[model samples]
Target: MSMATTATTVSLTSVTLEVADLQAAHHFHTAFGVDPHIRLRASEAHSTGFRGFTLALTVAQPTTVDSFLGAASDAGATVLMPAAKSLWGYGGVLQAPDGTIWKIATSAKKDTGPPTREIDAIVLLLGVEDVKASKRFYVGQGLTVARSFGGKYAEFASGESSPVKLALYKRRGLAKDLGVPAEGTGSHRIILGSTAGSFADPDGFAWEAATSLAPTPSTESAAA
Candidate 1:
């Protein structure tokens, strides 16, 4: 008998949120399959802050996108943008109770694939003070740039086969783009998974290297 060894790829699974109501926040994120950490802070006001980031969830179908948006609103997430048809596909945005923003979409021109959760995958869109510097920093961390435009935006393609996508955006620009106030303060209260040692991004978004001892499944997907 012959044995085959498959390689395991890295992904940024969940982004943490520091909220005043941990229980409520957890309930809200449960819709996204995220298990938030229970935390206590020195200042009650400091317990919650805008982390200057938005999550992008991609689904396999337009119907799924619609369903997810409805679910988001029902789960207490405010719809920043309603699901609609666009050049890209059917998509929209949501603002979670804990202040996290999500832009979700499905391919408009392509056929919807397998059925999964309303949010099948996530893209971490970090709003940075400086886009160019942030892009350079991630490149230094061994991440390859999938695409970029002048100093305005850049997407860091994941190394994992089905990895969580990441991107950089101007802080105020992002806030304004999302129809929200352009302000970020206090602790980010978020955790990002990274193959690189745990460290803060140029914008203070933190990342922790993969440390789980569980065996990687042979058919495990990076997108999931």
Candidate 2:
């Protein structure tokens, strides 16, 4: 029996940050030109445009670097780098809270410059059991389906051309191609922006959908 092969083209879905204190993190981010928009929630704030991914600050007690590594290991999160003291100061590695290897760091660098250029897009790739069904559901939700490859894959443009794109694919093939071990059904997950609730795809792939607010202008000049 020939196993079906899925294409290997994975786009970034979302990036999230978890901080110890929402207020303090918000203030620090603001100092770096990353202004957080206040919504109805007190502990949550988000950025505007492609500039902001998602920021979450919870009341987790500070753990030693070793403890943090242990927690990540227990959570099945891959450790990109072991925690260690660095020239920049502080120490942390890159690891996803749940398997994905996102960069986790404790930066000691001082804020010496303005914010970088805004992001151009946020890409979302979903791994699904049934691509046809997922496509149908998205279409039913009034989203325009742009590009599709048979019943195996589909892509949708947010219609704004703001660089945010959503796509769905078969789970096993997706995981295989991405080199991510299969973790059962609905392995895809998403982290939606502040307003919209985050969700996981049929294959457990994570995703988040949210309208971005405009950013506040800064008086500081860009860093060299």
Candidate 3:
């Protein structure tokens, strides 16, 4: 008698992280080596690799983790670690509120290089109402305003705490630059780093002011 044979197939899916701020999370992830072309929407960010996996970011409050998990009962997102105050003063975790196990932490013991990464290089831009006022706010928050071009653009840095430099520019103009469609509110998003606070520009462009994490090896390499 002949026996029948069947082949099994498997595919990798996208990984999404629920963050308090979309733009901030984008900034942080970009610094960690995620590409920006994957960001498909204002509220959503994406990154891709040949390894066939994706990373996404969605907004959620720290206190809502339990509720989010409850809704994703079938999705298999378990709390690898519960949400709690981090040693760095912000909420930290090593799990997703509604997905597979992933490392999520608020620490900057990653990048130790000066904050020289350009905004264009990392796809992070700040939208502000008043460039000068925004510059002042960042400076007061411990960032060093490196320079201000004309009266409409400003650059700030936090040294080795982050890899990307922060910028403050006119909101509408920034939207035009990024080719973002006109919408209602003009709030930006940013991810707080272990050593810096994530915030938006005056115009609402989000930014992540944090250090980069070391490059993670591909799963194939581990298997090999």
Candidate 4:
């Protein structure tokens, strides 16, 4: 009898936002309607400026985008870019009270139905110094490339049940898209939940095995 070996693959199972205030972060996310999709960790990690990344939410239509943006604003998120219509779609940018930037967007310019609270996807876009190099690094860590646009962008494939998707973009370009300057220092203040293992990427973003992490937060609690 011959034994078989299987190669392990990597994927983003969840995203953990390290914040200074646990209860406050929980309350904000609960009110913003994103509590079910993310995890929270109490970290007094010294970090400042851009943090080199942004979380993006994709929705069905422009009205949905507005709905999410409104919720975020009401929850105390500072409006970085007011919701507006652009050639690609309608979207807006805001910074959470914990200092993480978020972008809510929709590809549909017109509403086909009444506004919904449904979120189609949550994307974790890392701003890296070198897109190609970072893409190669993730590929080496067992992430299959779902899409790549030269040195400008790259996306990794995740399971259908994945709570979050992963992508890469040029740091300056990402900042420009979010209507902010690119210069940032200190920690990224975010940790990725990975199926592969715990390790820091070349750009300094950290990851931990999903098995070693806490459960996803609910509207009731942020305990991990």
- Best model number under TM-score: 4
RMSD of each: 8.0, 14.6, 22.7, 3.7
lDDT of 4 by residue, 108-149 (tens): 889999999999988999999999999999887888899999
With a 3 Å backbone cut-off (N, CA, C), the pairs that clash in candidate 1 are: 162-222, 162-223
The full ranking of all candidates by lDDT, starting with the best, is 4, 1, 2, 3
TM-score of each: 0.73, 0.41, 0.39, 0.92
Candidate with better lDDT, 1 vs 2:
1
Relative to the true structure, candidate 2 reaches a TM of 0.41
Predict model 2's lDDT versus the native.
0.41
lDDT of each: 0.65, 0.41, 0.36, 0.86
Q: What is the lDDT, from 0 to 100, of the residue 185 in candidate 1? A: 79
Candidate 1 residue-pair clash tally: 2
RMSD of 3: 22.7
**lDDT for each residue of candidate 2 in 1-224, tens digit (9 for 90 to 100):** 11124232223222333332445434434432224322111222332112111121111122333444555455445555565556644434433332233222334343234422232233445567788988876554445677899888888755431233566767666555444454543211224332223444443334355445334311211110
User: Model 3 over residues 1-224: C-alpha lDDT tens digits?
Assistant: 11113221111111123334445445434433333322212333232211111122221333333333333332334443454554542222222221112222233333334432222222123556677787776555455666788668886543442333445666666544323332333212123232333444344333343234333311111111
lDDT of 1 by residue, 74-145 (tens): 899989888878787788888887767778788855555744564566677788989999988777666678
**Model 4: CA > 4 A from native:** 1-6, 212-224
